[model samples]
Target: MAVSTASPTGSFGPPPPTTAGAIVVEGLRKRYGSDGPEAVKGIDFSVAQGEIFGLLGPNGAGKTTTIGVITTRVRPTGGRVLVDGLDVTQDQVAVKLRLAIVPQRPNLDRSLSALENLTFHAAYFGFSRKARRERALELLEQVGLAGREDDRVDQYSGGMAQRLIIARALIHRPQILILDEPTTGLDPQSRLFLWDTMRDLQSRGTTLILTTHDMAEADQLCDRIAIVDHGEVIALDTPRGLRKLLPSEQGVEVVVVAAGDAGTGTGDPLEAVRSTPGVERADVVAEAEGRTTVRAYGAVDAGDLVDRLKRAGLELVELRQLEGSLEDVFVHLTGRELR
Candidate 1:
């Protein structure tokens, strides 16, 4: 379970002469202006056909700029990107035809009904009138907007508009779909619905490249993930593989209610756990509702840790063993929580 870390010179060299990947980026770099900062710096990764690849990073980590280059919206300051073997810079039109983008914000035609939106998008791809209508209806039904096809998109709820946007993106059936923070503003139920929709699209042979801050979403959907930070790829692996980057594969979450008295000798529960035997590392992951939740990693003896806390006058509210998580990996790599 060794996780691979990418270095600018070695691991991220040029891609192979020929690749079956749906999208390939090599030595990608971008800077805003003559004196401005570099946004993306020599990044490399590939997304296979029919694979759900995730790009994860905190804001300002250059993932957005990298995605901009991939979608052919931003001209790269260096390196090259290929979609289906066509250079994004040289084959803009051809590359665009094979890719569809679902932006984080809903950008459906506000003046048009949901059905008209889909039909118009398909028509732009040169579908026949009959084909446009049939395709629009099918997509509308598939996105659970069948009964609301005639309603103007501006009147739709956030989730509904998002669904319409997804339907519109699929109208032309592009070979690759780029979803930028697809479920960002969605409620839990709406988010789950979209997750299912994405899965369905994948089942139908669509390759998806997702950029999301939600570690759970990346863990659930991506076949592989590339974690970009400070304009470089820090780590790339499957969710499980990334978890292996932690000091230990096993961890324990302990929630303790602190005693109110000022004289309580528990200097810092987190530090205590760190000094405890068999514990490799410990972090205070959360503190709220008058409870402190500490996550300890390594060959931790949960019973021993709890007993030590009790000895120090800490009321143990909950204790649970945990599988190392993607969030842990992110923190381990960047030393910052994902925003």
Candidate 2:
């Protein structure tokens, strides 16, 4: 169904065929009240056509608010959002018709059966009875819920319910799909199931915008990720590209017998580690069972680190490369982990 008419800033016309990208945000900003804190502080980014873009950030970082604005559920206090070159403020109805949103929480009717919910949502898009039935059945089978169509939504498992929600969102065959924390609380099996569904959609040339706290999920699915913190894009790159931002880009964990064993009796182990070849920085990260675990960052050389440890009279209990990851980059840039 069409959304409420928008003000003059929005448009009622169709988009041109040669738009540069699927979605673009220029200096987007949002604040609750006259004196309220700015939830989004003028962030800019863009999603290419048929690309899976991710928004990764901690809670209250304005990820949800940004999605809400692009989906036209919330209005921006400043800046502009364009979907298919259609300004969100000026083309509310046209933009709404082009995109579908699967929110963080499922909003299906508890009283309605799965089939009922899909068909009901289809009706809002002006589908005929026969069309709704065909569309509902097709989506049900596509989402692997063909046999559970008559069951009440409340009876479905968390994963099953989420699948139904996705099916409902696709009832109108939107060009863009926005998923907010789509796999936040699913079991491994369910998570993988939903991932396959998402991959299928992308293969069919659907543009996807995703927001999630799961770094691994983002790494696995997103073609590029924008890390937002305090309403800013702190980092924007592919998973591998983001990992390269970490200092040292490579690391190794060394377990020493004692702090003093890795240096002079009164010297600092961290200092000794830093002085080692290829060791950019080293810090004692853990202590347990009379052993000290030091993580050395940089392009760590195992042989060099081991030789240095031996020269300091330190016994190397273990040495292994520490893989860099998106999470490392997130913590590095945000100064705090995703809560």
Candidate 3:
């Protein structure tokens, strides 16, 4: 789906009584203190119902702050956010009732048993004694904790605790599930399990808003992505659409052993590769033991890159062709330097 990008100075009026999506963020802005830098600045986006929307960016790029506004944890300094057609600031309680958050860090009740944790949360939403009990048990079984429901959460592994947290979030049967770095510390197996769980929830018609730094995870799960940077939405598109923003769709990684004692070729390999036809961008990605890996993206020809590197006095050790990915789109938009 095509996504729109909002300008920094753009003006956005309040949403009507109802909106077309589950969430709407319009010209949102937030500043820490009177003189503090704006954590989020005039951002705009909307998440369709039942879509797995992603807020992707580097650390401190306002992804979390944007989520805070949507969840009503942080007050916006300017503009507005609407959750399920209800203004976040004006309808905080009603909005909260419709949203469930799985925070970046584990916020499970360690003192409570796994089952108690789920039931206790459900109780807040006014579930009756019998209903909460049955719901908790059902969720425990769904999250793979059926036999361990009586165990204290303190004894649970990181993965198990995460699962319990997910179950707890669902106790209220929220309309929108907000996952902030849901799989940060999980092992591959646990991450995959959570991905399956997310898909299951989506299948049941739950809208998901995800904040993540993991490019692969976003690429694999998000229906559409909003790339935020320095408190603004720089780009918004589907994964495939975002990939098209790059100059070329193919990439080549050429690993070369320096032919000289300087640990570099006699000539400038980077310049030579960049000057090669069909090569749009080139960067030295890695270097160790006299081998330097140059990753170039564009309509790159592996054979041409090898021959050019050879002419530059670099001996080819390995060469590999790669498909364009969200990571490349990120680097292209956010720059190659670590923030």
Candidate 4:
């Protein structure tokens, strides 16, 4: 039997010791109206302190709704969400004090300078005039905006604007940082730079909860990931751990070379291979130079596949095993790839 990865284990009672986790969500749920569709069904998970935990799923999978509940932006129909030991419902003010959220979109005031934006945000936390300026300068330097402190935010590039927003979120020194699609439209270089910034924050002991549809981003950054679908958590585990849950631990790729004028003549060699015993799934990934490349998943017997190909009057050009990946596990669990 194939093994299944379950959600993070925990109880729904009051908050645990601070060392247990930075965020505890028990039976978290939300619905737009009394009869409206349930955006977030009953779900539970925990984010350990100082760890970069990821909520990974396609659009409308409840990633954003769950974050809404944790940040107290959307009220939950039923659940217990504790941020740094304070319940989000009863301790909203206290919860807000311990966490900072960087939304999916840029919310900076384009009219204000980068320094001015951070300065105003710090003021809300009650920093004095002198203190706010000092903190803003320090943060600008930290986010690599030291020289651009006085530049208007409207003039900043997308990456620079994102960095400033992150700096603004840190003005009050939040213990937990929540980012929703932190690099949605960033270029490759920008995305890599942002990843470096995330690593730096983790090194400083800031627990991060980020939502992303980018599989590579989640695999590269998160210590643990929760694959949510249809408003429920389908699987949760470390990247390496999740990859192990695939129904087919091994993959096989085969290239067929048909003889003579029979070249590339195939009614469906891919489907024929899928019907073979022990083959979980098969797809024709490519075709070129009178050859068809087939990707087969599962504990496929290479010898048996080669024999079947021979019986089908096809010649074997090449064969190899494919490495397991998280995308395979995700498709197996969710029944669909990320959109």
**How many clashes (backbone atoms < 3 Å, residues ≥3 apart in a chain or on different chains) does model 2 have?**
7
Query: Residue 12 error for model 2, in Å?
Result: 19
How badly does each model clash, as a count of residue pairs?
A: 0, 7, 0, 0
Q: List the residue pairs that clash in candidate 2.
A: 9-90, 10-89, 10-90, 10-91, 11-90, 11-91, 248-298
lDDT of each: 0.83, 0.82, 0.84, 0.82
* lDDT tens per residue, model 3, 1-339: 111111122222121224459998999999999999999989999998889999999899999999999999999999999898899999998898888899999988888999999888878877778877877887788788889999999999999999899888877777788999999999998899889878887876778999888999999999999999999999999998898787665688888876654334556668768978888888988888878888888877777777778777888888886667899999899887777
Error of 4 at 247 (Å): 1.5
Give the best candidate by TM-score.
Answer: 2
Winner on lDDT between 3 and 4 is 3
**What TM-score would each prediction reach against the true structure?**
0.75, 0.76, 0.75, 0.74
* 10 residues in a row with least lDDT, candidate 2: 1-10
Q: After superposition, how far is residue 215 of candidate 4 from its true place, in Å?
A: 0.7
Q: What is candidate 2's lDDT per residue for 1-339, written digit by digit as tens? A: 111111122222123224758999999999989899999999999999889999999899999999989999889999999999899999898898788888899899999999999999888777778878877887788778889999999999998999899888887777788999999889998788777767777786778999998988999999999999998888899988898788765788888775453445423456557778877778899989977788988887788777677776677788877767888888888885445
Error of 2 at 101 (Å): 1.1
For model 1, how does the per-residue alpha-carbon lDDT over 222-314 read when each residue is reduced to its tens digit? 999999999999999998888878766587899988766626567477876787798877899999987899988888888888878876767
Q: Positional deviation of 297 in candidate 4, in angstroms?
A: 7.5
TM-score of 1: 0.75
Instruction: Output the TM-score of candidate 4.
Output: 0.74
CA RMSD of each candidate after superposition: 10.1, 8.0, 10.0, 9.0
